[model samples]
Target chain A: MKIKKNIPLIDQHDKNGFWGKFGGNFIPETLKKPVEDLTILFEKLRKDKKFIQERDYYFKNWLGSPTRFIKLENLTDHLDGAQIWTKVVSDLNGGAHKSLNATVHCLLAKRAGKKYIVGDTGAGYAGKMLSMAAKKFGLKCKIFMGAKDIKRQKPNCDAMRANNAEIVPVYTGSQTLVDAVSECMRYWVSNCDTTAMCVGSTVGPNIFVKICGWSTSQISKELLIQIKDEFGEIPKKLKLINCVGGGSSSFGFWNEFMHYNKKQVEFIGVEAGGPKNSKKHAAPLTYGSKIGVLHGAMQYVNQDAEGQIEETESISAGLDYPGVSPLHCFLKDTKRARYTAATDEEALNAYQLVTKFESLNPSLEPSHAFAEAIKIAPKLSKDTVLCINSCGDALKDRDILKKRLGK
Target chain B: MTVSPISLAFKKCKKEKRPALLTYTVAGDNTKKKSLEILNSISKYVDICELGFPHNTPIGDGGQIQTASYRAIKNGIKMKDIFQIVNKFKNRKNSKPLILMGYYNMICRYGENKFLNKCKQVGVNGLIVVDLPWPDNKKFAKKCKKKSVTFVQLLSPTTSKKRIKKIINDSHDMIYYISMLSTTGGKLKISPKKILENYNSIKKINKSKNIVIGFGITIKTINSLKKADGLVVGSAICNEISKSINNRQNPVTNVTNIVSLLKKRIS
Candidate 1:
């Protein structure tokens, strides 16, 4: 694998929040000023020394930064092909990579003199993480979640309640993540003066996508160094795999490696394929979905011929969204990142295989990625390094796993 | 350029020395025939009628309008049905100008050119896309202008003085001023006086533009906001339709009576 020179980095977006015509601020008039103010404040804070120090302190001391990057020796030996490594983001506080963005947003809220923080969640990890961060920062917290997700991710909902965050049930269309986001945005419209909306993923309007991506990019920032330190240099024929819901964890995992030559380091995003025979899956990119706007950004959306958003189904509550991130859409069009889908049965099989082989329990969201890695790992050369971001723990998924796996 | 029907309606209201009454209802709320009958009944009292395209996910709407949309969508309302409603309402005698209100996804799916052509053919005088705001709506607004359809722009209390100027300059014939920072059907968070003050500040940017205040203008609050060029009552009308359906009464007659009362208050 030869390294190429002068390749433009995919990390930067234009001032209007567009990543190759994918993102823009399409919010209602009631939120224009508030979104503008947030963007201005975030831009200033990202450059301020004191603000950076405060955010880093929380990332390192409170939420546990630089989570481990280790090889899955047993799984690699069993595959007998590429060596598999994982960035154990599930080991972080709040038990997922969601805390990174939540901590940054809570800090942003405090810096802006806001007394309350609001957020939306799908799998409940984001809501729980925001609740934990808000408690640490002494700000009032409210989380809007789809009524369906409330039932699916009950343990995390209980954890959010234990943290004293008020949970608002969204019973609108599909009763899922997309509705939760819409409800949260409506709530933010009225409460913008006193509250800051902490968007859970790299979706939403331009500012939110930028903010979430900026905060979570720390994953690749650390992984870049960890690779050099572990193997003496960046490995040739490296492949990175991560699951895409609203594409937060995967974007963070692949951010630093995006500038590398596409031939040397490949990026793969796995989407939820739902049931084996069901047509209702959450793989918008894999299904060749049309470009449409939802939740304030233009992206690949699962919509009907009449442009109405279609309902999506997935065993993992987080990945069951009708739209993907704008950045992922850009990557897909540019042929920078390859995307595929893993069925519910495959993810469940991967979950079992990981637990049995490595004594590790990964959340159902990343099990999609592991399923994809398992398929292609055996076909790759033994010298290739395949890194997967185990983004969350399966503790919150006990109920679903129990019913599905009967274990 | 020929004056849009929306502009002509505003001029007529100015001559009458009263704020123009604008009523909103879902296109196929309850049923297509009843929804059209309701429109025909209410058109006699209102200057502009806004018919909503029922969306499964209406983010900017509150409980009342969301319920109205759900009822319409559940009854199998389609895009063609909304256009047919507009066409039938326009064919009626002494019909008011109709404005189609919906999210942008519908337009994207229908193809912008084809959607605009359909609106032109159906006699849709104006459009108010809830999600497509300034800069983003520039292209679509121009497309509407080419089709002789007024593309209504929206302003809110949160709009900065600088942005107000830009939006008003690009506005077609009318601008919607959200009286408060909330979704449709919310309780008025700010005083009518404060909202007027904000409205006046925006009005000063371009006095010629027809600015209507919406988002929480009920019968109780309509009289107080009657000094503006126009007043839009959406959720209140939607609430009336819901109540009429629950009571097993004629929704068209009940909705007409409410709009008549609202018009009398402003007049």
Candidate 2:
């Protein structure tokens, strides 16, 4: 069946409504009206030139953007047949792709007249981003994280504390992403009058998705220039691949590429396959799940026939979730993007190969994306310059690497 | 408030001068056959019945309802089985319509149209979707009309006059006014005067439909709402069944005792 292209997701031209299959606000009853209020107030704030000017000042002076992209010369030589390039998102002010988005969200919240910000973070990158942004904006910030994550990503927790952000460690339901998100929603419900829960990924159908989408523009903008300069011609098969760790990076790349339909570039989304064939992975789109809304957004989910969520797991903490970005669901259904998975071992091997050859370490989450590149690279010739997003650095995964692989 | 077609069916079967006894049991709480026997025995006394479809996360539900839902789900109560339970009740001599009350997540997962069609095929008289926002879905009401099923709407004291009018206008089934803002069980203090006033107001707006009060309706409260079309009691009776569980054995005697006691309240 031929799936329709460019599904109507956004409300107005600037609004981010739905992406191919994923993205919508699927929130609990208590947070519904408050989210609507935030949406309207945010629209009003987004237009204020003063807010934009203040945000630009902070981005340039506080969170430095235009972070230089490093060419992986050593890795390209080792790969032999492939011209490999990885975006050094860690060079950004907050040291991850999250800063690019979280700062935007914090500024948006300030413009919306919100006094405080509440958010859930699994990898702790987004929490740090929100904390720093909140500090610059002179607003309070609260971050909910998994208890296990609190111990694993202590550096981020400390950074958030340094920014004077409130840290809440949640221990419910595997003590992971699901629980932190639940706690964040609870906090939003209680403090909706004073705060806006800024989601870091394109997970929810809120301003956070738009913020993340905008942040990811760096990848597309940089790639557009780099590809043109290196190839001396606009490349043909411009396949955009990204790790689906709540889909922020994928959205960043896809948002820029989705408009180029005639390019006919296949957008590939890679989710973690923790232990392939085992029930320990976060492949919600591939497995049969219901198309109900969550986190105040409508999309496909790993819900039972009755629409209750089924628990999902993975080796990478950030990718281990029972849900996906709703727009991804739409994309998958409409065939705009093909959603697939790679095993834990494959990602680990790819992660090591990138670090050993390129002399650049990447977060385990993006290694899943690399794994996909490795699979597709063997099929293409030297002409193929597959752009796989390197979402974060290996510093975040040092402990994870030690536990999974001996030093 | 005068009873509407759906609640009137429940009120018709209710014994006069007796509290309307409603059985609270999971569709497949124990084994399917065992649950069926419990339903058959309880059906003899109760005026209206509620069959809960179990789920993994029964949020907003207290311990008793949660346990009941777990047992039913564990015993394999698929959405298809709910229709069979209602069908069995339809085959019985009862005049009340078998009502299925559950969360919206379950309905969404099950495909709303498919579930409604199954409900109609099984001869279910009414449905209480806990998640369906009231009056906002006229299309859903139209679907219920086609199936001859009453789409139940909840009206709490928090419901304003404007909201109530919208609910009454949109509702295909009788109005189900929650006694309190809390979950289905617990010792809640509900004002009879408030219920009477809500009921009176609903009647004034549309005397065509029945207005039953649920969430918290004990014998005392039921008597107080004598002007009410009927009383809908649940978690309390399920709590009673839960107390009698000794070594996972079916608490048939407890179910019988609760029904008799509830019937005696009106008598």
Candidate 2 chain B — worst ten consecutive residues by lDDT sum? B13-22
What DockQ does predicted model 2 obtain? 0.19
lDDT by residue for model 2 (B21-77), tens: 555677776666666677777777777777777655443355567667767776667
Listed in order, the DockQ scores are: 0.76, 0.19
TM-score of each: 0.97, 0.77
Best by TM-score: 1
Which candidate wins on DockQ?
1
How far is each candidate from the true structure, as Cα RMSD in Å?
2.0, 5.4
Model 1 lDDT tens row, B88-192: 889988999999999988888898999999999999999999888898889899999999999999988888888889989999899999988889999998899
Clashes of 2: 30
